[model samples]
Target: MKYLYGLLALYLASWLFTLPADALQQGFFFWRGQLVQLSGALLIALLAALLLMATRPRWLEQRLGGLDHLYLLHKWCGIGAAGLVVLHWLLSKSPRWLIQWGWLTPGARHAHQGASWRGLGMELGELAFYGMLLLVIISLVQALPYGRFRLIHKLGAVLGLMAGLHSLILLSDPLRNTPFGWLTQLACLLVLVAALWSLLGRIGRARRVTGQLEVVSHPAPDLVELAIRLPRAFTRDYQPGQFALLTLDAREGAHPFTILRQDPDTGLTHFAIKGLGDHTRQLVQGCRAGQRVWAEGPYGRFVLPDEGATPQLWIAGGIGITPFFAWLEALARQGQTRCHTRLIYCVERPEEVLHGERLRQLARKSGVALEIHTRQQQGLLDPRPLFTDPQAQCWFCGPQGLGECLASALPAGRLHHERFAFR
Candidate 1:
């Protein structure tokens, strides 16, 4: 569905490219001005990508209304912008124009000696366009695996710089002549500079903090609960439903983990880790107490809203219950206990339930009904009962399959899923 939405948006926007270059000049703005508008759309697309990268998960939900939709919109908009840029180029230049301009000449010396010095500028713009194309193509479905996406995503930062350069070199006259044109140029320049900084590895380094693992408690097999003492300056904490990536080895990349508990008194960050893979399995099996760990967080936008009417329905599958634990902890800290909260935490086996006792204790204390379902005992998690009672704002985290199941069963506005795997 997301892919379809994205492709459809791109297709609709691509029609903008089909317009003749003289169409804008026929009635309203010139083709140059239309290019500026297209550039503005590109700028907006870049800003959306930035928001997707930088915003915390919990804040994103509230700010963007919902992340899944925003992500879908962002993806589609980006693809459309890429297509428009292609259209813009095709409209701007013809094969005969390239030949006449002598940009297709074999040697650099021939380009220098040509009757048209415009060849150099055209060549540079073409190079930039090709770079943007490469970045956009890699960002799509292909070349995503084997860590190429990270490198290609970084390469995407160069697109803005290239586009800005393209704008400056090609539209210099309009840039200096009109206020709107100048504003467009300035916006592109600012965004381009920002992108350069990100390329230089500056943005991600800004909000990171180094902390030590103060306590480690394995409440269940293959799961490790950690209490991390954060730095004093890192005082402004996150909401209950947020998540962060824990970096035990700063030398290595960060591992995404859900925040299970936050100490209101001391401002310590707590994370729950399930030994799912090589990294986490090692962390659970080898990491000891008092180990120094850097936390690059807190991200994620899965939260119950404060809107007094939306009854919260928490559905956590397997280790997905970690973030909800933080919710309970935060609610308890606030001293506002409500009975309307319905927690449906499910696990594969009865013994696989980590921190089950603590969750039940919190549910009992807060007057929230705790319904536990063990797949080994019941065969499957029956979603019929959970969906029968509508009017519940469902916040869920689990494997992608279960999340999709809940999404299919619930209305658009009702289901909010947080993917710990992706973002």
Candidate 2:
């Protein structure tokens, strides 16, 4: 969030300073003129960035620390851009209300110098603005299903192209010829390319691979464990705690799932899934053994340190236990988890503890200190008692409330975690 906001602020300040001296005239013309370029620059820049993030580039994910952080930035960039659009519209229209209220006098209307494509650009920009706003509002409705949200969200690329064209055509002559004009033009070009990439459905094409589901079992009523034979994909080394966007059913789209275990010798991977949403519920119910499955990348950065000497604490809540399953299995494969490592799993019921016996077996083989806290028997977790050392490093995956409570009570830099949601 800070990275995205800081980038926006830096862009706005730099662009503002690049404005020519004479363009700094006082009164309505100056404000309106400045507003035009400022709004256009902001909208084009932000929307372009949002579209770029949609491509899910692996390098950007690494730079951002994890896929979780990258998705968070992507979501907030869209939201921030949408909000700025409203503010821009308000400022653009405020003069009319001011005039009606006699709070200001109307200046004489004159032909502008760089209105060459004014008629076309104005019409296109207005249409695109309203359309983008509608799509964004639809996207924000929590009641809307994921499919509906995705369908509406794709239209943003079309509107983004329109917005890019609008910005390129309507930039004032003063800005059109300056070095910053070249920068704006480059930004617009990138937006055009990103929009086309999105429209063509090339977002995750490169990393996509196909496999066959080898096994499926209901570990519990709501828990599913799947083993897949991804001979091509599994040839590459994958870190424990990494996940994939799995496409068991094309209609449901590729949903992210953490890799629960892996068979390096046989090119197989395992996933433990719990029905958390409509799409996930569909996956839980509709999955079949021996069916074709598609997956994209072993993505994420929730990996344990290879060389840290300090004792480490790992916490998992509900389905968040999936990643740690892979971690523990990896530790077992390496002979043992470090003596300093510990894992605490919190669940509401014994029925929801995914593969309790398997987890215990893995812990025994890996030498990890394991703790399970159930609501019925142990209530909620209080880490303060366990957090005796301030130098200890903690990695947590759980409900937001649990993370927040733990963070607030613990040492500032001790908790290391990211929300495992798009937002």
Most accurate candidate by TM-score: 2
Q: List ranges where model 2 is wrong by over 4 Å.
A: 1-6, 20-25, 108-116, 234-237
Give lDDT tens digits, candidate 2, residues 192-211.
Answer: 99999999999988888889
Clashing residue pairs, backbone N/CA/C < 3 A, model 1: 57-300, 57-301, 58-300, 58-301
Q: For residues 1-423, write the lDDT of model 1, one tens digit per residue.
A: 354356336633653644666674463224444554555445434543543333334454455544444455556556766776676676555444656887543222222223354565566567767876776677675535524455566665666666665555555342344544554455566656667777776654655788888888888878888889987655365667776667786444566787777776766777878887666788888778888887765655675457466577888888899877877766666666767878888888888887778887887777678888888888777666677767877888887788888888888988877644432
User: What is the TM-score of candidate 1?
Assistant: 0.75
TM-score of each: 0.75, 0.93
- Model 1: runs farther than 4 Å from truth? 1-62, 65-74, 92-121, 142-148, 172-176, 204-206, 264-267, 276-282, 285-290, 307-311, 419-423
